[model samples]
Target: MEERLQAVTTPVLLESSAAGFSPWGSILRAIPEAAGDVPALLALAVEAGETWPRPGEGRTSLLFELLASVAAIDVAAARVFEPHLDAIAILSQAARTDTADQPAAAGSAGGTSWGVFAAEAPGARLNARPEGAAAVLDGAKPWCSLAAGLDRAVVTAHTDDGGRAAFAVDLRHPGVRCEEPAWVARGLREIPSGTVHFDHVPALPLGGTGWYHSRPGFAWGGMGVAACWLGGAVGAARDFRAGLLAGADAGREPDQVALAALGEVDRILAAAMQYLARTATHIDDGSLAAAGQSTWSEAQRVRGTVAAAVERVLQLVLSNRGPGPLAFDERYAKRMADLGLYVRQHHGARDDAQLGRLTLKGDCPW
Candidate 1:
């Protein structure tokens, strides 16, 4: 993960020494060892913000490659970095200049951690009511990941016209309070995603209703998350491959079943990677529309393809590797657990249904 990711993002990293040594090289290599340290992940996120450019701004491939690399090392660390970077891209897409309050992407004070909280649930809702020249958030917004540790967030809340709007709010404000982190999930344990309450928390509106999702960058952001899933699948498959090699190294003949599983994984990963690369080119060149494609439909295909590949790879690794790693190896078990949980962000059949609808509307390539 470190080697490939470093190579992919090398051109974009901020050089710190005459010998072209990058501070990010140290950070990228150190993140996996950091495990789930919140402070450490935040520090890495800050470094990533200052270093990485916004996706669809000419280096979208690097953005996806970097995300895959971080996720390959540690999903928990990527959990902290992904949303922080996405928030900056959102701010950039809105065409508003970031100020001292907003900061530049991720580098900021120790307390300036950021997360994106836009997941909605019935009854547990956050709303932005009109307040003269501004808006005040009220009610509960569920799944506000790391809200307790994060100082700021780009959150989507309901508006008065029954549409949703995005807002950037200071989580440190007195009116905001993170509910007790009741997160008991074994995967991504470092990131506590629960409810956060806002009692008249003043928020600066980011975009009007429909502006957030309708923008082209929204598809790019979704694809960025898919890259993380793709990376997690890659990491899982790599471990399985290593186990097969270990038996061969010990003078044991390679099992054909394991070899077959590895071959399938190779195909899955290769196709998914190609899809991401092609779509990223479309995004950078503004060719999706030129080629009679919608960015949303293209994003759906990449996400669906990568997510299906992840599920198949996971099944193959678990079936072929047996229970040894899950039972005895801490790193292997944690990686599988994290991958299993994190990939659920794909929304399964519901997303497939969306893509199916797009195809029916003739938005998909046959």
Candidate 2:
């Protein structure tokens, strides 16, 4: 497992360092202003979408590679890219569903970009009512990333039968309105995440009630997000390593303490990669199903592990390097903030409690 993990991640790191393969450089060049422009970031995402993993192309491998590459460059940019990839996956599944009357016009005219707005919060009621041939979505959906920028969205709303349903919404419609006062945070400001009000906006329902949540791929997608977190951790590790190397070159050799901290970072990251590789293989081989293990359980475990690993990496880097990276280096500062914000997407205590329940029930395979 260790060998396999190293094999998958090492090459990606080496290739990223090679000439003519600067994903981060390309992102900076494309969006030079970094003005938190949604449309511009979406455009950059669309252009780079081709480089992402395609269907049936070892999604696990590509996911790890992408997280490592993009996270190293800019985790906020990685945040943008992660949703695009997930939207593609969700839309593809929607396309395959028997409920899809016509083809899902995802990447059609007007350069449509997609986002998943499934975060459920009270006071923001996004309910779906069947009206003749289409579903009418009314009320507001909150925590919507790239709300203004996304041309289309896969939204989760309450159905008429008191069940949850997923729908494809066209944000360009007249009834749809994206609210202002986007997320105010230290990092990931580039993601224009806010509330979007739907005044009877027409939508296309995907699959039947509960299909979106019940699908195996749903858990797979969650693990993909974990991959992004792991990648961001790797990026942080790289910054620390670079700083140490520079210090060494300047005749300030890192003592045994600094060396030990670096070693610990490597150990944590290596363990994370090994876990990811094993999980990806299990997902690919349908091992979870065979073991009667729920994908949700597996996803939670992987997410929890990766999130803890990233936090540890950040703490160690700060302890060893002090506030220089965060204060002086703009890119490093952004990476740290972006990673801290992004990883919080995982519910901390609530998720841990759920995982404990799964373990008690003997549902966790690992």
Candidate 3:
């Protein structure tokens, strides 16, 4: 596994750097060949834990690097097309039964944490709407990581039929447009997470009738997003460490504190990664209810951990540097902001309610 990660790291890194702040094209081209290695990225994420950021400036670096590899391999096609079909079939089949628990695996979808994270492309929820489908969409996806210049985007949309469905839309459709947003975000800025507009555009359906959220892949996708966020947090932690330890005269006391904090962060990330892996496996084994219940809680836990770690490191750095970090350093400031915003995606409180319903009420509502 180490050998595999090392072998691919250079190619992805070179491509990411050359591609610069707008490397979606390279990512798209790389996907078909590198899709199989996604699990490797997850393993790396788990191994790096929260300390991965010590080596880099923030989580965006590693996040984009991993995504670059995924795009290099083209996993999205399989994730969206094939698994979507399977998920729909399972959901439809399960719906026919008198009991909702007949086969809890109705929502399984392939693709590791990478696919899951990409699913949360900002405005995904909005794009997959009836109005968004029919009308001209003028809004932008603040951080659409792999969206720019892609051949196709499998986005969620509400169909004319009044049901939520994932649709495969051509990025170059006459009505479609992609541009970087003019606003500033805390991290992941290189993602081309700009705006995509559809002027009464044409699109193809991704799954069957009303099978969007009902499918199991949606939940799996959510878990995947949480995993990626965890990876970024780890990267940020690493960066913090490297910065603190770079100077020969750096104080040992702060290093000791950072190291201890890193250990706690590692524990939290490890638990989150395990939860994600177990959740994916449970879905595969026909245990959707168990997977869903656990996923909600895990997502929240991961976010809480990441937010806490980032904040802690930020505070420590501020105390040590005495306001140097606030001098508009894009990497540090943006990262802090991004991590803070990204944690909200974990659905922590919402997941708490979901877990309560699944565990205490003993029911799988979906």
Winning model by lDDT: 1
Q: lDDT of all the models against the reference?
A: 0.80, 0.75, 0.42
State which candidate, 2 or 3, has the greater TM-score. 2
Q: Which portions of model 3 miss their true places by more than 4 Å? A: 1-148, 178-182, 192-195, 247-259, 287-334, 354-360, 363-366
lDDT of 3 by residue, 1-366 (tens): 655333332223311354453433333343334333533333333233223221112233333334323322222322222222222233333342121122222112321121111233534433444443233232333344434433344455544566655554555566766665664644433332455666666544445546656554445444444444544455445445556665535554455666666566556545544544444445455554543455344334434544454455445545554456557654455555555555555555566666565556544334
Which candidate should be chosen as best, given TM-score against the real structure? 1
Please tell me which model should have the higher TM-score, number 1 or number 2: 1
Indicate whether candidate 1 or candidate 2 has the larger lDDT: 1
What's the ranking of the predictions by lDDT, best on top? 1, 2, 3
Error of 1 at 340 (Å): 0.5
CA RMSD, predictions in order: 4.2, 5.4, 12.6
Please, what are the lDDT tens digits per residue for candidate 1 over residues 81-126? Answer: 8998998788778765352255533345642567889898887989
**Which residue runs of candidate 2 sit more than 4 Å off their true CA positions?**
1-38, 54-57, 96-110
lDDT of 2 by residue, 156-255 (tens): 9999788998888888788999998546798887775788999979888887689899987788888878888888888788778878999999999999
Question: What's the C-alpha lDDT at position 81 in model 3?
Answer: 22
